[model samples]
Target chain A: MNNVYLRNSVRFILLILLQVLVLDNINFRGYLNPYIYIMFILLLPFETPDWFILVSSFLVGFGVDLFSNTMGMHTAASVFIGFCRPGVLRFISSTRDYEQGMTPSIRDLGISWFLKYSIIIVLLHHIVFFYLEVFSFHEFFYTFWRVIISTIFTVIFIVIGQYLFYKKK
Target chain B: MRQLFRFLFKYYFFFLFVLLEVFAFIMIANNNYYQGGRMLNTANQLTGSIYQSYNNIFDYFNLKETNRQLAAENALLHAQNENSYVKITNKLFKVQDTTYKQQYQYVDAKVISSSTGKRNNYLMLNKGFEQGVRNDMAVVSPIGIVGIVNGVSNNFCSVMSLLHSEMKITAKIKKNNYLGTVVWEGGSYKTGTLLDIPSHVVISKGDTVITSGHSLDFPEGIPIGTVSYFKINQGDNTYKINITFFTDYKKLDYVYIVRNLFKEEQLKMKGVQHE
Candidate 1:
């Protein structure tokens, strides 16, 4: 258990540094910034308690926010995703079939179920984040375009990251 | 109590979800006052530094252009120095001393990161609070004015670039002295617009626009741009003048921060009078 904790902690730090130092600065056409750090919250063990997931999500996003100078957009999005994770899981997979301590993985949940799970959570997170950043519907259509475009890139990054980092280990 | 405990347990996930969502909502709402600013600024610095390193690698490709600009500036300075020498000789013959305390001083700095293709473009400089750069100091290139300093860190500062929508500089026609506000129209680095100029003013294409010196930030007579085109608004009596900026903001690498030494004293004096 201590070993598991240490590995996760190291991964967490590495992801934060990678996100802020490299990915955050890659503004593809100014609107397509893909935030892959949310993958950390997505990949947590299934048995991790609700409070731990929520708090961890908040801290991760707060860390990103602190560096990006955005006040709470990421934190809010992350917490929202954390809060909705269980519902998304149940909706995608039957409770009896999901082993208590077994983490959500492509091997466990199947690729289709995992994709659905990630899509819903990532969509919710991006919608909340982009809307909050825009802070107004005055440019409703323009902001909507930004949300859609950014979500596409973010989802792509999140999935690629998950595949590369969390492959059967 | 046992029954209540069972009920709570049955609805545990729902309660947890609601609680977490509420927490997120509170965080989002209160983000401005939270410590997020420091974190975001720290992150900006980290990312900015990395970008600076990458930019330095790409900057070598522009060495020829940079060299040409430096040579041009040197030639202009040499001409100005010669004129000053001649004026000194005349003043000496007349037994007069024209040397006086300068109200403005310029400090050279390099642009580490600049964005022009955004709705709210900003430029980051290599100099900051450690170098005596503070918020509201006017930044300019040899060609013309760039923007004002907005935020300052120990060794870096961010300027609200002229490309930002929120940027408004006091500019006037050098030929007729007709003043107007200069603002970016949200995109296209090649052009910005001047608003509030009266239609009666004879503003022609290629007329020079310079800073009004009305603000304590920018000293008078700083070059801004030249009038590219003008048209009378359909309903309003004002003319909309499009300006072609003198500085090629996209190719900007070096800039000078102009500090008004007497600004603090003047502001304090004005405050006393108002009080």
Candidate 2:
């Protein structure tokens, strides 16, 4: 339990710092900013307390918001994902049960399962986030394009990060 | 009452989620409407210090480009210097400093962080209220205008960049003195739209657009951009002009925040006119 807490705490700070200090600053043709900090929420232990998920997601999201100056969009999206995480875990795990100390990562689950889980979570987060940023349906297709492109970019980075970091463990 | 307690205990997580979402929504609404939610912006103490330290590390990489720009500006200033010109007609031309009252004062600031891709983009400056920075002041680069100060903290301030959707500038065509409004319509950072110029104004490609002295925020005749493309709006007897901004907002590092010394007097005059 102590090991789990230490790992998550380190991951949370490192991810948020990498996000605001590095990824957010890279203006790729004015649009493609991939958010990999959601991976922190995704990799939390399967048995983390429900309220803890909600609160930690809020904290992480708010941390990003405070740095990037997007006040509430991140918090709203992250909280929504946290609320839906249990259902997503259950939906994906109908056949196989999560063993003790299992996390939703490429290391714990195979690539296919992790990809499916992350794609859904990232899609949901981006849909809520990009729309909130745009705040208007007038340019619906434009915003939709942003959401799709950013979601793809985010998923790719999250997968790459998982492989790179979880190599030794 | 026992059943109620049991129900609440069983579903506390859902209620917490709802409560958190409502709070987040409130923040979004407030940020969108007020435009000055001071406590949540990067200009605050914690985030500002972090960005400052980050800038301290990365600022060296930009030194070469920054030096080149400063040298160019210095050459221009040198050419315009009084000592650079010989007195053509030396007839006791005593120049008095008191002859002209200063109407605008500029404070130099470095851009610690900025973004141009977002729908509503903003730049954060290292200077703030303690350094005489105030909200609504005009931020301009050596090449052209940059943004307007939106929120100010003790040691930092956030600028609403010219690329923002809500930004509007009163602009004039230099040759013909035609007035219009410059606005960003959610596309490229380098281009903006000039509105309210009449269709029959005979404007052509390469016409220079400059800031008009209508707003207290900016002094008159600051270079905004030049007309890149234009067409008559058949629906409304106006010209739809596209301008390429002179200031490259993506590479902007240093800016001058303009303080209108006569702002109070201008407001007082407006109040008199209203009566």
Which one wins on lDDT? 2
Question: Residues A1-169, candidate 1, lDDT per residue (tens digit)?
Answer: 7766786687778787787656866656555667778878877888888878888888888777655545577888898898888788877774448666566666566667767777788888888887776566666776677667777787788767767766574
Model 1 lDDT at residue B205: 90
- Over B145-227, each residue of candidate 1 has an lDDT whose tens digit, in order, gives 89988777777877778876568899889988888999986436768999999888887899999999988898887888999
- Separately for all candidates shown, the number of backbone clashes (residues 3 or more apart, or on different chains) is 7, 0
Listed per prediction, chain B TM-scores read: 0.81, 0.92
Q: How well is candidate 1 docked (DockQ)?
A: 0.25
lDDT of 2 by residue, A11-35 (tens): 9999999999888877576667798
Q: What is the lDDT of residue B127 in candidate 1?
A: 82
Q: lDDT of candidate 1 vs native?
A: 0.76
Please give the CA lDDT of all the candidate structures: 0.76, 0.89
Judge candidate 1 at residue B237 and give its lDDT. Answer: 90
- In candidate 2, position B246 carries an lDDT of 97
Error of 2 at B261 (Å): 0.3
